[model samples]
Target: MERRDIEIFLTLAEELHFGRTAERLGVSGARVSQTIKRLERRFGVALFRRNSRHVALTPVGAALRDDVKAGYERIQQGIDRAMAAGRGFSGELRIGFSSPLVGEIIMAAAEKFRTRHPDCAVRIREIHLSDAFSALRAGELDLQITELPVREPDLSYGAPLLRDQRMLAVPSRHPIARRASVTVEDLTQSPVLVPADAPGYLLDTLVPAQAPSGRPIARVPTLTSRQELLTLVSAGQGVAVVGSQAVRFHARADITYVPIEDLPPIEYGPVWPGGAQSSRMRSFITLVRGLRQNEDDVTRSHDHEPSD
Candidate 1:
């Protein structure tokens, strides 16, 4: 099938509604209908089972989708790489990371990117929570992999690259530290230490203002860095909620990391200054997304395996 045809079919397969597919593709509903009908005739099979109410892929259609999606992505990546080379993708790409876990992931992606485009130099730096967007806005960083819910008007972000369970970090001597896991309602019992300079939306994920039961969750917004936050928590100033990665990467004798059973997983993604994106930025995003997709696929496959 042609690229446009593949796009239409894939979109329809995803949406399962002709009207919504047309809306997504910015085409008329009749045009979408005609294209599917034409493809059905060419293939001599009904790709979709559609009537007045619902639509779904036929068995063959499902197989085709599974096979074509990866190839389509690879083809698009090829085009992007070619365009990037033609545009001289040799300039330095300055990237930032907010946390140690994200920093490690960025380093891995940078290695792959350098191997693929040796001429392009990749520079990595840490983006402190106290000054989240200053480096990006000032052109000091081309991109950053940080926590999600980036709502600034001048910034754009990609799909989440990493997601981990939220964990609470408290002093080792704290009463709740001995528990297997803690719930959101338990947050009311301790004051949460939070970043002093981050946006309220982001702070909410790390240290919510209230528990699920409407009880106020006291907070101490006095930290500028992860180490300082942990130090405060270790000193028994207050507890902190952080990504589960902290348990593995930031373990300390004075602090304890316990999973928050009731909180959502924290997400990290690429954020950049809003407007036209550079070829280098786009290439990096594509690489990270591809890596994340592969990891997710592997995890899903393992999840479905039959155990002895």
Candidate 2:
């Protein structure tokens, strides 16, 4: 019926307890009950089944929950767009980024964007790759920077802004550190330290068919962040597979980054919600596209230079 009613319904549907939902919404239990009653009266249908112990969504309420949530999200997006329009292209751009390279590119582009549109504001949030898609879908993020070829039908992904090859990071003293390049089979005997955010491409393409079995020696799922993974590798706890950008960021004395010739190269790109393009978003995309072309030209020129 009303926005507040929808919010209350969603909250109650999730918590299924009046007191808990009220606590979460920072309202009184009586107010929450009153709101539900008003909603039911307006709809002429009961939305919840209540007992002394708990509350559960009725069949009609269960069906309505998703539709209401979608409607609320669309309404919120419209409000944000209206507010942004009132301020001109001078409004904030909330970007979601996953990989480190994406962050660097966005920072570089933000500087350029700001110089041209000084009144425009930029905010970047580093999120899990999986969460990036969901955040974009929910209208929380204006743009996303991630690996290319995003499969979601609701989103459209652009071409690569930059490409970085995967590298094997090992302790300098490790036996394979002296090699010019390594392969997945070469890592079979070593305990691999995987970053929780290791891109899907690496997982599908680089992991060995069978690691040398022995209690998995050391599986460090505890390392959630890239910094933590690098730290563990530097400590010689285990070897890690990471992007060249990561190696550039943390060139620790203990770890040596070697090119892995056998693995697939990684490419980072920009993604946005399908059918939600804006003038500001188009401007940012154009900037990134120009940057990518410049990078390609530089690479090509270097490739043509004579070898010593």
Model 2: lowest-lDDT 10 consecutive positions = 212-221
- The residue-level lDDT of candidate 1 at 133 comes to 94
Q: How many residue pairs clash in each candidate?
A: 0, 0
Model 1 per-residue lDDT at 227 = 76
- Each candidate structure's TM-score, on Cα atoms with residue i matched to residue i, is 0.79, 0.60
lDDT computed for candidate 1: 0.85
Give the whole-model CA lDDT for all candidates, comma-separated: 0.85, 0.73
> Compared with the true structure, what per-residue lDDT tens digits does model 2 show for residues 100-159?
777877887788777656678888888764344778878889898876556677887665
The residue pairs in collision within model 1 are none
RMSD of 2: 17.1
- Cα lDDT tens digits, model 1, 1-308, are 98988989987886688986786566889988998899999999999999999999999898998999989988987897789778988979999999888887788889989987899999999988778999999989999999887999989876566777899998999989899999999989988888888898888866778987899999877989887887789888898888888978998998989999978899887888997678888788767766766777698799999999
Model 1 weakest lDDT span, ten residues long: 285-294
Error of 1 at 227 (Å): 1.7
